[model samples]
Target chain A: MDRNEPLDRVKNRRDSALRALVSGVPYMTWLGVQFDRRGDELTAVLPFDQKLIGNPVLPAIHGGVTAAFLEMTAIVELSWSTMWEDLESGRISPDADVPDSLPRLPKTIDFTIDYLLSGLPRDVYARGRVVRSGRRYASVHVEAWQDNRSKLIAQATAHFLMPRG
Target chain B: MMVGADDAGRDEQARIAQQFIGAIPHARALGMQVEDIGAGKATISMPWAPHLVGDPRRNVIHGGVVSALMDTCCGAAVMAHPERPRSTATIDLRIDYMRAANPGQGITARAECYHITRSVAFLRAVAMDEDGEGPVASATGTFTVER
Candidate 1:
């Protein structure tokens, strides 16, 4: 029994679960969001599209669109992190009977967004960090950037209600 | 630029503002329509769509979509103000979800530009379904005058 082989299997299962979650929400797929997984970190990418532009004068991406992207990123990050934690703690089997619904979707309680700069018409990247997770709620901080990570286009914080398994 | 002070001029300004909002691609994609625009208030409506559902089990619209609707409504309210600048940009927005919206019901958001200074505009909005007594979400935000 190779240790690395088991880890690869788990990764494959997690990836498939993530795909189903994204495709389940039509808006997420419509925005052309793609997830990049690196060990414990997950980043969401929003490909540029002409239809995302809100202000044609400055040709900037819609502020609402950017906020929505950040919100979705936070939820996705929380879902994956929770799933891995459950698997490690033996709370849920990695090979659970459920195929389409491995991770439960969290409900948003509140969301706040700060627009530091206008989002240009280009690929945007976002990463969410779980600030804290309690029995009933989880708080996440997310940052979205286009050209550079340090120079963020927008930052958001959201609190979500975790569903009981 | 100083906004027109006459009735006709104000009407013309409202028309222009409506057109600008209509031209927003994302707004169009969301099926948003300008319900009304006055001095410092604007109302926008989003029709129900199956694709907007966030929770399949409950069939509730995503909170993000509601937030977007409120944000857009607030922006429109600011732009429709009699003392509006040439352009405006969202500085920050805070939204609180009171509860899940009813499935298959259109959401309407009404926003008011309560205060305006030299460089910033303050806005507050409430989103509701058919029942106006209970709000789906409420938002407060500030926009920078880009003139």
Candidate 2:
């Protein structure tokens, strides 16, 4: 019924799945990832440190870091949101929850990114929003912003393949 | 103080550069070599691979590989800096495909950090082949520097 209960259940039951999600990304570990979720939107922030500098004057960030951050956000969003049955099965009957018929996994089919503004030093944040969680697929719009809210560093749209009956 | 262009400095740089490029297996498989590396700048190159095809039918290399290459080289540039060794995470990256890479053409990436503050790091990289007039793809990214 409570949020912590589900997280605990996942931790106890799906350890391998969770570990795979995190361990698969060796580079993500290199960048020190911090994860968070609010409602349906999932976010991850990587704090800026000295080792990330490519040029002293320009100080470029790594593209791998961005790709990994987006992927991680997607993974968390998919894993945390349980379909209706999942919550009901766990003994939590909340009418607000979506139906149980919807599949849990979202297979990433394709993604496109556009670089609007250059990212500068400070905290880098990625917010992933579910565009459409359909029967066969799920799409998301992820926006990454840096220190300045007005300047968007990168934006990505990802399509995932959802399991179907 | 200005460091002279001595063999010692050059060799040290080469060693450090090798360490950065070694992180990516594909880059190693492609025989990537670092042309130069300084406090915050790096240039890495890998010869074109026929096997790096993206679409087998069209013989186009997958955009994923290009993205990976861009990420790897850009990360190397970031790690080459002689500052704190805090981990760096990629917050976001965008790659624009200027043109498809020529089949059998070697590829090279030049990446640099435009600006870095206490929390965020900014990066840009250009990938090109021998022709050099135009880039195959250009990337810009943000990274969070871990303390």
Name the best candidate (by lDDT).
1
Best by DockQ: 1
TM-score of chain A of 2: 0.64
TM-score of predicted structure 2: 0.47
Q: Which ten-residue region of model 1 chain A has the weakest summed lDDT?
A: A92-101
Clashes of each: 0, 36
TM-score of chain B of 2: 0.81
What would the per-residue lDDT of candidate 2 be over residues A51-160, giving only the tens digit for each residue?
54333344555444455456556645654454434543554422212333223334456555655554565678887777777767777777788876557787787766
Fnat per candidate: 0.69, 0.10
Candidate 2 lDDT by residue in tens digits, B1-147: 111123437557757667545544334654678887666567778766554543333344445456666776666666655554356656666666676677557778888877777877788999887788788888887766665
Cα lDDT of all candidates, in order?
0.83, 0.60
Worst lDDT run of 10 residues, candidate 2 chain A, spans A93-102
Q: Tell me what TM-score chain A of model 1 achieves.
A: 0.88
* Segments of candidate 2 deviating more than 4 angstroms: A1-155, A158-165, B1-11, B23-26, B82-84
lDDT of 1 at B77: 83
DockQ of 1: 0.75
